[model samples]
Target: MFSGLSAFPLTPMNESGIDEAAFVRLIERLADASVDSIGALGSTGSYAYLSRAERARVVKLAVEHAGNVPVIAGIGALRTSDVQALSDDAQKAGASAVLLAPMSYQQLSADEVFGLYETVTRSLSVPLCVYDNPGTTHFEFSSELYGRIAQLPNVRSIKIPGVPANPAAAKAHIESLRALIPSHVTLGVSGDASAAMGLNSGCEAWYSVIGGLFPKTALAITRAAQAGDMKAATRLSERLQPLWALFDQHGGSLRVVAAAAELQGVVEHPCLPLPLKALDGTGRQQLAVLLDELELA
Candidate 1:
């Protein structure tokens, strides 16, 4: 069903390239924490920057070391053939499922978007998670499109980003998505800041960045929300607000989390791709204080 707390671990790197040793250590930590699943090659993993072979290697590493946790590999690309080939490779590497976003250099039409999934679905035996990340993909899915894609064969889940931070609006949006999609298709939310509210709104899963670094804490909140303890969930969510504010101010979690992971000694270096900078000294100082205050450090 792909429900519960799915951690999106950072792809650690050293001077030569991907730090295989660090990658193994991080995955082992998540497994030790009992995260529901592991998502390798996700946005946090910088799937786009790596070569095809590098991505394949990352998936192989994830499937091997993630310790019985289902690995969801990202197979998104600008072209259909590349996506299909990656999906095939992820399946060969023993990934439980592949995540896809309709990323394009030129804008894609609705039919094009539908065709992309249809093509990939036809080539895969495993299920797919439709990644509706408009912020990065530059392609948005309408409610009708959600219904249409939910009908596609082997489309098991929808990973929607930026579910409103407000609990009321988040609930309404979740309800609308529930009404629009088939019951078989589970709804997963991805924004770390809004995740608690989104889960409270009845999302089946949380594809989380923070969970990668602190799965124990992430699981605590998810378990509380799942157990119908709103008070506990809200309190936990409030604890994360400081970090969430940094994410908001910086425009995303990738850089902020990269810094936090390094500061907490989870990763050796931030090692973000060009043009994307990690938090400065001041930002790290602030993050350190927040992590300590929230007991995340």
Candidate 2:
């Protein structure tokens, strides 16, 4: 399993469709930065908006451009069979791992959740990363649910979100889970603002959104912390304060990446599907400030 800051880049899109050249350029640029791994077609990558064919194309591009770095394919789907099929495609595309988020739908029993992972894992040749982003799912994994998942054979890691406000509580939850689960089941963290929280809490790894635009900054934070230099990590993360705020102010990571991808000229138009607003004029201004501060331009 890979560790450190893993970035999820937004897919480049325009009026016609995905911009192949621009997408390649973005990946090449990211590879120059210190990313431990790259995750594609994730929430930050706007995976839900793309068609099945488009998703495969995006995953293929990411894996090819990633070089020696590990690739985590986000194969989240609405149906169990669809998810399993996507997982199979990821393995075929050379992804080292795949992320599975339980999609929103009717109330799910524990058996269904188990079956979802079972079906997807049984169909795949590679490890399956269990993604639990409750904000979108409208359902959180209880410690009991995670305990059940923790025992599964093909399960690789659990991508968990930070607890509200209290780092101690978050640490306690993760520690409790880790003690119950085997050491092979890694605990991956989301939300870069809480990254320090995750690291301090003994999280082995993290998945990043800001890394899509500022990979160096994300890597710096993770590296500095891993080296036990808290001060350097704090200052480096503080420099990325604007991007974090942009993620929150814009409703989520998808909007933040879409907006930044446009400002950086990495993608043409940077338009998103319905329900997610592309960068408005003011959002564009915020993006410019974000890039200018990072010296990305």
Candidate 3:
């Protein structure tokens, strides 16, 4: 469950609330593509915006439709008590593991962050993935913090951010962190654009956003890296440079992927929650052209 491509699908929504049918379609799409795992409610799934009940439903639906593939549910919340409650919900829903990013409104100290993981891990029955997403949470983790949290009972994987672009640097970076955590804890890489480089550099898994919508394409890169065909992995990643550029142009991947999902008719137009708009006409048009050019349409 921890070592391969874990696809994080969008939790499509409508005026009537979650578009259950569409969400199911996305899950089945990932499952049919034989992704190693299904990550429900990561940042891409809009987990933080949804209510606890909504998150529970999303994980339940993911597990139900993911066939034999494991489901890793995101349970990040601002409060430790709430995180504990969310963790309970995920475990009850049959999540194979739970992903957690230390979300906060006020800045948290290193001790506070460690305390959060320590408190939550005690109550957790399923394995936990440390979600070190500094971009969204605005809380960067030090190597020492990672070592502390990873020592907790259920810590099975640490989802670190992107690796350095240079191959040697990327390898050294991963190796430095790898030495800090226990060998039982696998290191998974986020940051979709650098996924190929991270995997080729020795990371064990790719916690991917693009894989959610285009599992086969992402799986190709993962397979290449796993087979030690670094050239093939790099080539595949370079080929998707246009798509990566859209992620940067649009500020982040959530909106661009939402646009792609709409263009593909996999979800309704304007699928994101309020205050977060879909790509504008110009952005959508550019995305549509790229999708066709890249055969992703």
Across 1-297, the per-residue lDDT of candidate 2 in tens digits comes to 447878878777764678778777777767777588888877877787788888888889988998877889999878987887788788888889899888857977777887787777766678777888887876678777777787776787888886444657877877888877778888888887787667667777778887776787678778887887767776777777787788788777777677777777677664576566676788878787767767742
Q: Which window of 10 residues has the lowest lDDT sum in candidate 2?
A: 162-171
| 119: Cα error in model 2, Å | 2.0
**Can you write out model 3's per-residue Cα lDDT over 125-217, one digit (the tens) per residue?**
899999999989999999989998989999999999999999999999999988999999999999999999999999999999999999999
**Predicted candidate 1 versus true structure: per-residue lDDT over 1-297, tens digit per residue:** 379998998887644678888788889888888888898888888887877888899999998998878899999999999998899889999999999989899999999999999888987889899988887788989988989888999999999886886788989999998999999999998888777887889998999998888889899988998998877987897878888899988878888888888878777765666666678778888987888788872
Q: What is the lDDT of residue 264 in candidate 2?
A: 70
Estimate the TM-score of every prediction: 0.96, 0.92, 0.98
Best by lDDT: 3
lDDT score of residue 77 within candidate 1 = 92
Better of 2 and 3 by TM-score: 3
* TM-score of decoy 1: 0.96
Error in Å for residue 252 of model 1: 0.4
Overall lDDT per candidate, in order of appearance: 0.86, 0.77, 0.93
lDDT of 3 at 132: 93
Q: Tell me how far candidate 1 lies from the true structure as C-alpha RMSD in angstroms.
A: 1.4
Which is better, 1 or 2, measured by TM-score?
A: 1
Clashing pairs in 1: none
lDDT head-to-head 2 vs 3, winner:
3
TM-score of 2: 0.92
